[model samples]
Target: MIDHGLQHPVMVELLKKALVDEALASAPTDRSSTDTRIALQTGLHRKDVRRLREEPVPEGVAAPMVPMAANVVARWISEPRFLKADKTPLPLARTPRLGHPGEPDFPTLVAEVSRDVGARAVLDELLRMGVVSVSAEGMVLLKDTAFVPQEGLGDSFHFLAENVGDHLAAAAFNLSPDRQGPPLLEQSAFSSELSADQAQELQRAARRLWADVLQQFLMSATVAEQRSSSDSGPKQRVRFGVYFHQAISTPSLPAEAAQPARRHKKKPTS
Candidate 1:
């Protein structure tokens, strides 16, 4: 927020307005009692509530668009045909090799993901972004597991909002008093007494595990989408993610709080 110029007061005002709006939405039919209910629920002045409701809501900023090249890289790493038996991405030939017309290659991978985008165009963008590299023999190697845009701050910010926003929303819903559905999956593993080496090892292990988990989920989701009927009901969206963070030390109580109270007699009653 300091970097983005979002100061404390601005954030507080945004939160206050959001709280008022949420309270209003939660009980739409209770509008007759809205001003009092919202004031009580959000601790906002009735005048402020009325003013906010009168003001026009600002339209949300759009999420940064991901390029087609990124999609090709994602498919390359996740699709089984493009992966080795060890589940690592296999180096792909830029074009089909002689006498292997049916072989899996870079061009075919791009075509499978999108027909309108040319394979060469996607490959060039990936190469320019340092996400992939080409060898002298025209074999393309995936340099990164994911298509993280290195040049743009907007894409990074968009992803930050998407991932963290959903995570916070899930937790908020789980803790809400009026929650009606089963809680979203929100669990983490912790080990406070870990050396730096152990933490590093765990982080690496988590990445490897995430790759497998992502692949399995994508395959399952693809099958489910193919099998489902669009006319059945409203469509749904889902996101699953994993994260690992290591700090120098685990959180602990402050020194004053951690220490026990000391007893002192009245100086021998002198």
Candidate 2:
């Protein structure tokens, strides 16, 4: 967070408040005694705890939590009407024909996902993120299978927070004594002293594995959505993802240094 410009004091205060809220929600104490319990658990003053609970959430303080752009991208890729014989998203015409019989144009595609948001607005956002591009023939093309905001730092940060936050929550729940069923899947592999070449190969392999896993999950989700439309059953939201990370340790220098220092050659007397 420090690297991301979330400074020490701000992060400390945020974590304190977060802990207070978590304690209130997760503790076995009565609701009326929540402030005291939260204060004790979070090491915050009771008065401050009460104030935090009573105060309204400040506007614009929270990150954007909506995934409307991502939803559109998902539908575009998975919906049969929007895909070609090869199961890839078809290049759409820039303009919309209100009653076209065949595959819908770009504007119609956006409208199908959300009528409140203008197609132009969605197109601009997708273009800015490099998820979509305009073809030479004036058609809009889907450049990526996912709606990842490449150009917007704020959007990227929001994604980071949401994905990591949920993953941690799942892990924490699995660790709790009260956890009921089998724990949500969590596993990792680690090794030290790997050469740079081996690390790169592992990174590439991880990416391929993640891509395959995501494709399977997406297909299952699309099928479930279709089946739910006709079946009378309760629905639930789910998020499935994969991540990879690599950290290299810095080598320590010896007191005498690793190599002898070169002496400067004396310049010829002018």
Candidate 3:
């Protein structure tokens, strides 16, 4: 068996980077002696081993509790989260065509389509992230009821990156029944429907949320890594705090009908 201990030092460092970010990241938590043994036995640079021993801890990435922390950070920085405003799953977006209502089994379908490796990983992530979660009956439930509409949590954020510029979409992947392993993953976002105002509102809401949270997120990544990680407990209290948007069929108000604006006028000699 290939003793992972003796793998490459750079490889070990990559794993360590993952562990610090909590971004589905990875790393070595073993002893330096064992690492050194593995290094020499495997002919990896002792310097690399040293780097692993002294790997700079990253922050705000939740905790290498997941995997691939670096990539997750990349995803987040490029697209924080693009919410959808539809209560329904993303595919029932029929415009003057066939009308149907259903979840469309996105999780399963995505799992199957990409052979359930990477995409399923994202699906599970959406669950763990509490964006979408598994219920008692093994059904997926939208965690945030008031997020207005359901945005494709993973898709849009990544899609925006893929479509507009020189993009290399991630490889397709799937998961096992137990849902373990590095995840065969593909991620992108899609929209169901959008009226002019709804679209505008989503944009505005996204903007506001981004403005409020982004600096904090970046700073968290930078600073949280420095302090002893004791903030998880407090952050848990913020559960259900994030919102994802989706489009819905809402009654549109005429442009004229709105909150009455108070008119200011020159008062007569009162």
Error of 2 at 221 (Å): 1.2
Q: How well does candidate 2 match the true structure in TM-score terms? A: 0.78
Off by over 4 Å in 3: 1-103, 116-125, 135-138, 144-204, 207-270
- lDDT score at residue 59, model 1, on the 0-100 scale: 48
In order of listing, the candidates' clash counts read 0, 0, 46
Candidate number of the best TM-score: 2
Q: TM-score per candidate, in order?
A: 0.74, 0.78, 0.21
Report the C-alpha lDDT of model 3 over 64-162, residue by residue, as the tens digit.
Answer: 323332233223332223123421233211121232343334333333223524544655555555555554544444443222213443433343433
Q: How much does candidate 1 score in TM-score?
A: 0.74
Query: How would you order the candidates by lDDT, starting with the best?
Result: 1, 2, 3
Give the best candidate by lDDT. Answer: 1
Is candidate 1 or 2 superior in lDDT?
Answer: 1
